[model samples]
Target: MECLTVKQVADIKGCSQQYIRKIIGQGKITAIEAEEPINHRIQYLIPVETLPEDLRQKYYASIATDGPPVPKEKAVKKEKAKAKKPFEAYTKKEREEIMQWCEILEIWQKKRNHFESKVEGDRNVVGYLKCEYPDKQISVDILYRKYAAYKAGDFGGLLDGRGGWNRGKSAVPEVLFLQFLYFYLDDRQPAVSVCYRATVDAAKELYPEMVAQFPSEQSFRRKLKKEVPEAVVRYMRLGEKECFDKAAPYIERWYDDTEANDVWIADNHTWDVMVMRDDGSEVVHRMYLTAFLDAKSGVLTGWNVTDNPCSDSTIFALRHGILRHGIPKVCYFDNGTEFLTYDIAGRGHRTRKSQRDVPKPETILAKLGIEMKNAIVRNAKAKPIERTFSTLKEHISKLMTGYCGGKPSERPESLKRQLKNGSIPVDSEFREIIDTLIEGQYNQEPYGGTEKAYQGMTRLEVWNESIQNTIQRIASEDDLNLMLMRTTRYQKVKRNGVCIEIAGEKLWYSNADTWQHVGDEVYVRYDPTDLKTVRVYDVEDRFLYTCQVEPALLLNFIEDDKAALADANEIVRSRKKAIRNYAKGITDRLPAEYKIDMLDLSIRKAKLAREGVNIAQSSVIEPIRIDPVKETDHLQELPMASGADNVVSIDIERMNARAEMRKRNKRR
Candidate 1:
């Protein structure tokens, strides 16, 4: 038998060494004295078999290694057979019951010590404890066991462990429970009853042995509610976007830090009302409103009503906003193609992929020095303008003549009758209604104390007050028109000039300078409202010239109208004259002597080739020197330099005569 130290036995029993020693002295446990003393005192070692049955088993298991029993220095501390429960693990009622029992035990112990006869003491104590706790039945054996347990483990030993062993555990088999989760945690979230039935059927087919162990549907639901987190269930069943909207943390935007015209948010909204086209056509179309709202003042600064959302409408709306409220420091835009066009916000700003070696043109916002920011894709809550659009739908769209609902399910039942009767307002009338509601009603309404600065004022009042302190960067009409003009793809200049297709009509535009740039590809910017002229820029976006529309000539030249013929002829004459003048201006800049020198060098090279002389082997060509002073004084004077006698000079007139003779010979 292996013997253990007093400390080792105390550690196994979870008691102190002094208690083990006291028990040993009282002959409650067997121990032997060591031949050698430890720390100048008698050393006592308890036999492993001398421990209690449970403690002996624990001790034997701790030292049951294949090797010899562990040395004293390397002895492993024995863990308790039963783990203690924390104080908080007990319920309030259970804790109160425990305290009441402890009080009774304390009193019983005092009474037992006070009486000489322990049996009488026990009878009286039991009577007293039973009366004090009238709801509980007390007995001598119960008190003795409770007291023993309390002395062994203190307060934790008094906790009632019945029924709590399976507190959070489920009766369902693991395989069946997981199968239930498979059917429940799906995008098409099935009902708990449905999932439970499916789980049972699956278990019957795949796990036949586990089928009998499956619990009821209610047990499965209880387990799900208790174990699975709400966020996890939502994410698994409703999809990531839905989970984010419901559970994700988000930052709140503060408008108090921003001033009027500090930031503008733009988005397109389809009006809930249907309107008829203004061209007297019976066809109806839905209107789209592209608008900009000031973030700070909640003012709808500018907007354009159109049949569809496009870059043109976006630019027009932005232009209107800038002209009315001055330039904004930043513009927030949605990830829509209409707002993220290359002409409005440039390429690669908010997109993932980018084109290599492609030149990014300066966009409208960039030209006006406004920073562009894009909201997260598919996240409508990030844009404050979406809220404005909602308000517009409620106040403006619902009150229109032909009110259609925003969604197919919400559409009015009488919309078909209204459409057939042409009860909808025309495009112009609808636009007028929108303008009236947005400017007269929406902007003029008082803010409902959303922001501290605009608590008691209307949006317009707040905007006006803020503008008084702001240095508005107001742009002129011409400047705004130029900045907001739509650009076209690379266009080549033909003989007629550069042609751009506008409203399905090919319109040609040209200027005096365009004639020189024929066959060159250039970018053209023009206003859709005015097709009279277009601004041209080089491939690098440098402003070249402004081109006006070229007049169309009469196709029939045989018409017997002298005035028309004369007008056409004069137009042709002026164009010819312009070309002739342009050529003359270029030629007049050249000196006669320079022209003569060029011809002379050509003639000399031809002459040398005829004589079998290689021009490469000859000296460099030297021009005939003329005396500047003598030439100015006299009308005709020819003077040669010192080395001119050895060089032969050709006459210009003779060379012309020779060229004419050669041409005549070829013709004969």
Candidate 2:
């Protein structure tokens, strides 16, 4: 074999030098392998008879298009090199550590969003991890830089570095809520006194190496929408989650709410909780609370919870509450169909028969003669039963306060010797604390009105007053009869000179005494179920006449386009100086100054003054004066301060009933 240089070949083949070079590099045609002086790499030469054949003929074809090919000997060496085993990878423990650090970084990132902590707070995390893994195979610097990138933009190994797949997803994001029970704040959970964000902070002295072991708060939250389970962190939720701590029983004898028989209000309230089962693991459950309340006593009957919707928990709670409390004459409830509608109209007056897929009335409970008092749809004020839930929450909060201390931490501690033995401390332990606090400090705490009111009455006294007054005003026999009657529209007719009509075919006749004048349209009180029946008098001992039925539309109180009553309120009170002045005469002189104030106007008025020095002695006047410091003694003579309707009644009427009561008790 013989070969020419690229320049020599171009000269012999009548092509450019670059063309010969292209043929070699393109690998479209081959040259023969031959030994060279230095064979360290490779040597080749072309065969003189080996010109390309027809398919490979024209120079216009893809002669130099393909990339260069390796020589067979060289290609074999490349294959053997590729076949060599790859380097060994990180061990399982190392992998686990990496996964943990990523998780910790993720959690730290989440904490940033929920807090105003310094950037240093976030930076310190990286600093810790770097210090912990100083001698690791993977550089700590790389992890820090990558995490910094994640902070700005979540691309790259964002998920990989955070505890995305590696972090356990057994609990929801609520597990991320860092709750610590402070024994100083609450003897039990129902009473809490502070609020902290559910996240880690500089306050948490976690080691630098641990960041990678936790999930970013964001990852935990995102996983919550998908329901990733995690351990729950328990805390006293009083001050942070709800009103448990501040609520003191104002009414000494609030109706006990835990009883099953009375008012059952079922609604949803969030818990700042970490639910712990018999196992050591924890979870956060969004509790659906259904507790029974004694309408008369304001006592908590009982309560229950459920993890999800369409649960049996609410119904079960109602059953338990009912059994605990006596079967209420009128059991109050909300409109959730699951509990009341399990059976038709059994326990309540109103049934859950709305067209919107609502459940029917509890026919089973109603059969037992238990009537339901459902709150007005969307109106929380319509039911007193629903209003008493704070009583239970407050009770629980007071209990929690006893067991916690400042810089608070809640661990299972032996309840004070007064409570019970620690090993068997269950509900019994919690209950003992509740009772002790209620008796000692809680009942002694004074509370009167809202931020205003009487200011110092104990919650027990206030609670007692509210219930007693409400019961007297709205739950008396007078209220029942009036509430039972229904409204009916009727027209005047001739029935032996009486108005007659039928509602549900029930019969009633309104003679001249009740019907007075025909052709006067009036609303009447009648039973809708039995129309002919007229309900004359009501529970409040008042006649249900047409005037009361249509008071707003029929009884017009307008005067000069404003309410007559409002206009009357602007008049001077009968006992004021203005009234006395007006009664005697506007021109009469006042003792304070020898000046006459003219009130009523005259078209042509003139002032009479004696210009001459010889005025009559009878015209001379003297000013009357009294010391204001002696006002207390004179007040009984002067009209009650001023404008008082009856000065004698001021002491009995003006003093706040509660204040007066307090004064009387103190005097005793």
Candidates' lDDT values, in order?
A: 0.81, 0.42
Error of 1 at 202 (Å): 2.9
Error of 2 at 126 (Å): 92
**TM-score of predicted structure 1:** 0.66
The alpha-carbon deviation from the true structure for residue 245 of candidate 2, after best TM-score superposition, in angstroms, is 24
Candidate 2 residue-wise lDDT, 29-53, digit = tens = 4666456666553444555445555
TM-score of every model versus the real structure = 0.66, 0.22
Give the Å shift of residue 128 in candidate 2: 92
Of the candidates shown, which would achieve the greatest TM-score relative to the real structure? 1
Clashing residue pairs in candidate 1 are: none
Alpha-carbon runs more than 4 Å astray in model 1 = 1-165, 209-213, 254-256, 349-361, 444-470, 488-492, 500-506, 519-523, 537-545, 551-577, 584-601, 604-668
